[model samples]
Target: MENPPPKLQVKVTADASGSEKTVHSSGLSVRSLLKFSVSATLGGKDLTPEELGELLSNGDGLIRFKGEWVRVDARKVRDLMDRWTQAARMMSSLGIPLVQGLRMLVNGPSGQLVQIPEPDEDCVMEPGQNLRQTLDILAGKVPVSIPELPSRLDALMRPYQKEGFSFLYRITEQGFGACLADDMGLGKTLQAIAWLDTLRRKGRLEGLPALIVAPASLLSNWKEEAQRFAPELILRIMHPSSPDPWQPEKNLRRKDCHAVITTYGMAARTSALADLHFPAIILDEAQAIKNAGSARSRAIRSLHGERRIALSGTPVENNLNELWSLMEFLNPGLLGSRKSFESFTRSLERGYAPLRRLVRPFILRRMKTDPALVPDLPDKTEIPAYCSLTPEQAALYQTQIDMLHAVLDEPDPAARLMLILPILARLKQICNHPAQFQGTDDYAPERSGKFRRLQELCVSIAARQEKTILFTQFRSIIPHLHDLLSGVFGRSGLTLHGGTPIPERQNIVTAFQKESGPPFCILSLKAAGTGLTLTQASHVIHVDRWWNPAVENQATDRAYRIGQHRNVLVHRLICRGTIEDRIDAMLKDKRRMADDLFSGGPEQWLMNMSAEELNNLFFGSPC
Candidate 1:
């Protein structure tokens, strides 16, 4: 048998529909020919380049060359091309990164049967390389042995946490950054400590030490956990107040420490701390860096590190751009330029799966609601208690606005600010309760909206026999809440505030945890939001909206943390049609600009609003 007229010519045409290219010669496209050529080469022994030319030169019959005859299997080529196309399409659409992309192409439906049995004949590809090994591990073809915790680890990990540790190790092994975004109270701290410990034991962190930057309040928490769990590792706490002050840039080389813990405030403010290099840098409550332009985010991003990981329960608490911030910090250039990242994200409201897939290899998140993680965990529900302001409260709100207007006329800007700050405080107070703003013990439910909502909420909590934690920013309003909730609960509850004595705080926490204890507990948000574990209360009522979701979530976690046997219901009491509502909408929108707007925190939020803006925010809609 000689050969068909023309051997095999593949013509490429522009595809308007974006489907695979169409073929012209024998109705076979270049893509098809490429796939076929790969199969012909891989099906048997390799063919030398000169031999390949002779086979293609035949221009027909059964691809006979050398002394061998290889049949071009049409059906096999189609089937194989379809698989390759399927995986390739997914990779292309998601724009999966290099290492992950190759792994997917080789394992995902395409090369499942064979680890790319042989390189494609058309392209220059290295066969039998490290990439194949990585693919093997990713696809589970090569078993990933979950290593035991270091002998020095005094702490134990949950089954899921151990899995998390393995995930981080595998990704970093490929020279990539990762974000550990497990839900709040899910032991992200422990998983991070485990990663550091593993690296320490493996002697992989020789030239540089690991850095942990977190909120000032949480610096102690990290120190405590590292001491309790990674007892084998040395620790350094960077502090300005210490007699032997620590400065990372100058002192880092001389320090003999496995990990350095510092606050985002300290890190951002101190040049030395921000300039020090770390083998690994982990940011706890990573939302602090959600604003790419903020001093802390800028400072943390400036610090050099071999591996970067972010720990946050609410990674995108407000919006998608915040996710970009975290991603930018983790894998800077991986997501492409910020402008393009933002442009593409705008179209991803309903369909974010593609973006998720792209970053899948770099992010590991497990919510407590996962049945495998917490089989017996109770349901946690979030409810918004929208309320209307009482007519009397509305009247008082107007009076405060008037005072704010009067203060705007102060000749000195500083004096105007002094008056404006107190006016905003008064406005929030009037919203909480008219009596609070008046500096009197007026306890009239008819004068407040939040009070009425709390009253309504109590009836339901009473019927369910569940405990509640009522958090307010104003301590002055707590007595009113305690008084009001006591009647509904039919028993007095506990109250903790900033001024509560240190010794008495534990007693208050212990009492509230008991099943037979009070049905509700009240606290000022700043005081009890961080340290306590009040899991006994299944219901957490936000008497007012805290500016940051992270702060509010921290408060809610008092009950949502581990050890709660019953479902938790979080009720956010918000007054409708006011500044609160406007701010609520801003948080909901979560656009990139909104992140910058909110990044300054509450003081900036209050002070930065122009008089006109503040006026519109308050008077734009009826209370």
Candidate 2:
């Protein structure tokens, strides 16, 4: 008869405070927080390590325990011992990450029911009581109860918004990071605030302050929103421009302070925030860290926080690579290292089912167009207004195109590559207006077809007394657009760009949002694209196309999001028979796959093209 096979039983025990300790030292392994051990049994008899060693030394196929003969394959027993030794060493050196531990519990080590079968061969792994409870929570086998809404919160949350808060609360309470990726105008900020306040009320914050990081432009917005919605929470802004005039580190540590807000740029530049750890950290417009290699991304990741929450409507604006960056920040090691993840994504089959399965539980996304979830959201109609170039604009555009062709013929490939982006920038300025390209103060609408089209649209919009918000990527053109729109609408409108003072942005927004306020508000796309509400405007006009769907969508959502009672008509002014027209067509063709992999605007893909391809794309006929 064959010798009885050796069976290994592995057990896991989780420390109650492991998550807290792990947050302080990101480099430490999960094994430091959890305990693991293995035991061997042969033919219903237990064999001690010494007895097994003796059997191995004797080169025997049988061992005795409790005066019973237990036959076993010595080689198999030795192999099991070797496997356990290696697992113990790894567990001691690089403990499993919290996310990785949770995943391993749900899906075995290799994502199967059996945990690493090749190594274990005939092993049984059992989760201890605490580990099993965590598994139950992760599997949604038991409901996570949320505390009642804090009475101090001034605003009543909509049903969907309340649900959003619950989702954030559940994941965060369990020490898992969350991504609240609701549609742009769906009040991600409000949901986040509600959750933060609830944490305070539930005593979950443990007397440690939470941290909020956002763009420089949105710092004031966060302060105002928190003050309006959760006034009971003592909030502080951590920037030199703050009126409090106190050192940020000292002010942030005040016992009365519940939370502190800072800009991404400041977080990267100042060492004051480097060593501080929070009970929680919230990243507004979290896509700011989409490039994992960026200094901002690295700095944000280095800050200590128990639970990380990211808020963004366009989380994966570009590709899966960006999604990896966001996930890495929220839950490190959940997707393995960057190189391994890149390899995994490359090997993914159609639909990327494995990666999707691994990440779906942590990210929550809702669309504004879902009537069942948001019945009050108004319709958004996008209309592309194609316009021809004026004679002067056409001459400048052609001249630049000829110069690009000449440059592309250079003997050095690197020299040819260096000139493409600047030429593209010049081409875009020419398409916007000849005066804008020529750097002149001429604001005549007849000088450029796009400006003429804008005048026509604004005239019609003004006749109906409907408000409009015009967006452009260029800050220099804001003054010109303001001057022209003032003439068309016969009223002094507002302008907010990068230069707009942090304190004045809210005032400018309030001015535009009033019933009898400005007829039009000209904004720089990058500065005011997000974290502002302009529902008062019924029309949104793009003075120049970004050739990036996510960015333009964000800009338009300023007027199209939740509180807007009127239908939003988005006007995208495209220069016909130019790079803008061709790129627009290419984006429309790629629209079907937008959710999975929409790349950045022309600035990115254009650089990778051959010189010949660039020539054709720049001067290509309208598709």
lDDT of each: 0.67, 0.76
Residue 59 of model 2, lDDT score: 55
Compare the candidates by TM-score and give the number of the best one: 2
Pairs in clash, predicted candidate 1? 7-59, 23-29
Task: Give one digit per residue, the lDDT tens place, for model 1 in 137-229.
Answer: 543366655567765543466778778887777655545667888877777888888988888887756656788887554555566678888
**CA shift of 466, model 2, Å:** 0.3
Task: Show the colliding residue pairs in model 2.
Answer: 29-95, 30-95, 31-95
Q: What is the Cα-based lDDT of residue 97 in candidate 1?
A: 35
- Residue 305 of model 1, lDDT score: 73
Q: What does the lDDT read for residue 398 in candidate 1?
A: 78
**For residue 573, what is the lDDT in candidate 2?**
90
lDDT of 2: 0.76
